[model samples]
Target: MLQTSPRCSLYLVTPLLSAAAANAFGEIFAEALEAAPVACALVRFVSGSEAHAAAIVAPLLRPARSADCALLIENDVRAAARLGADGVHVAGAGEDLAEAIKRLKPDRIVGAGSLSTRDEAMTAGEMGADYVMFGEPRGGAQTTGLASLVSLTERVAWWAEVFETPCVAFAQTIEAAGTLADAGADFVALGDAVWAASSPAAAVRDAQSVITRAGVGVP
Candidate 1:
């Protein structure tokens, strides 16, 4: 059975970080966690070996656990397993996703993203993904504009209404966080909207407020 929450919550995504950058962002990440309740955090790394990724994940693990946040490693199932992360966020609903589920299910989270069609999302859910993420930029491309946002919101609504698995909707801006939450996202993912802000902690607080207000009485 899939787990569900009473209301939408914040899901944070890190910018692609190198080892040095990851070290620097650790403090900021802790501050954001302190500011509000974050459901999960995806630690993305610049293209590198698993060892390099592990190095970055090791330090942040403590802070994430301290804050009661699920720490997910992006696109590196082995690293996640070896490092004892909460789970792995696979980028597509293909063999990679299936393998992650096979390897990590019943013990760890295995979320699927980069789904381009409703069928793909359904496939991910059927394959036992912990959650299906929509509106995340593919290949590091930026997804912006009102049209894209509308499409994402619609997708999230469709999933929330029809599926048991949770849906994560990526918001391009802080303002969009509430919109996504009101549209029925199980989790509103904030990337640049929080990391790029002047104060990430404050941004997290703002996101929390909006999500709380929008999620009021949402079934």
Candidate 2:
């Protein structure tokens, strides 16, 4: 189980780092971590060579490590083992959650994502998922719009009331981050909004502010 404080925190996702942008992206990511209380980071590679992605992720891991943020590779167990990542995030029901637990257990975090239903999320918990993520973009676009945000917040609130397993609610905007926190998310995951902001660090700081507000007066 991934024990976290009652207060919600941030979980950052990379903005598709190509091999050429590795070094630069590393620098930016490190700065973002310094700007807020980020609980974890999911290294997402939309489309690229896994080998190249690993090569880039290797150096970036140092920043996340230094900041005490758990670093999880997206959808690749082998790469997690090879890169010595903190854990692996298996997306969708298609991935073998059992096998992933078998490989990374007793040490690394094995989180589940792309879960659309309560049944799938419950199954993930039963399979020993360290945590289950909700509201994350499926097929890369659905979660960005406004409709998904409302649905995600409701799910986070529902899960928080009913389950002990940690829930990470992906927020497409800083406003959504605060909403999720108030609704009782353990961690709010930030996506393109952070990277697209004029100042990524400032964006994180802003998100942190929202979460802090939500934390107040909540018993």
Candidate 3:
């Protein structure tokens, strides 16, 4: 589970990486972490066997831990266990999530994403997900535009108002981080908004500024 924070925090999500890219990204990730207080980071890899994925993820462990950032593996529980990642993030709120929780609970964080409805989100919370993410693009697609952002903000507002379980809201751009924070998300996830920037670390600083500004009087 995420540590409680009085204000919304940053959650970093890497672009899908290959083993060769992981080493370079490790440097970039460390730079971004220095820009602000990130609550956690989820590392996604290009399709590969679990052992291969674990090999790709291994080099990142030290950087993440040195920064006190919880590192999460996307969708592979076995790799996460093998690499001793801080947690695993299951893409759907179903048996995958349930099994992840059953296998790793009390020792690892299991977050749920790809929820399409209130019912699914509720089910994930009931099953003890460490956090439920909203607004993440499905299947490596580009970020959906304004309509999805509006819907995401609304869902985040509703969840913050009604639920005790922590919520993570994906922000497609640095500016959107503020909107989600104001909507009461406990953490705002940054993907393309950070990694696509010319200076990923600078983008992270900008995002932290926006979230801080939005958090004033947010309660």
> Top model by TM-score, which number?
3
lDDT of 1 at 76: 89
Candidates' lDDT values, in order? 0.85, 0.83, 0.87
Candidate 1 per-residue C-alpha lDDT over 1-219 given as tens digits, one digit per residue, 9 for 90 to 100: 224569888899988878777778898999999999898999888876456886788778988999889999999889889999999999879999999999998899999988878888899999899999897743445433224778888888889899989999898888888989999999999998898899999999999999988966643
The lowest-lDDT stretch of 10 consecutive residues in candidate 3 is 138-147
Model 3 per-residue lDDT tens digits across residues 172-210: 889888999999999999998899899999999999999
- Model 2: residues >4 Å from true position, as ranges? 138-140, 143-147, 215-219
What C-alpha lDDT, on a 0 to 100 scale, does residue 36 get in candidate 2? Answer: 81
Clashing pairs in 2: none
Better of 1 and 3 by TM-score: 3
lDDT of 2 by residue, 79-115 (tens): 8888889888997555577878999997899999878
Q: Local error of candidate 2 at 147, Å?
A: 4.4
In order of appearance, the predictions have TM-scores of: 0.93, 0.92, 0.94
Off by over 4 Å in 3: 138-147, 217-219
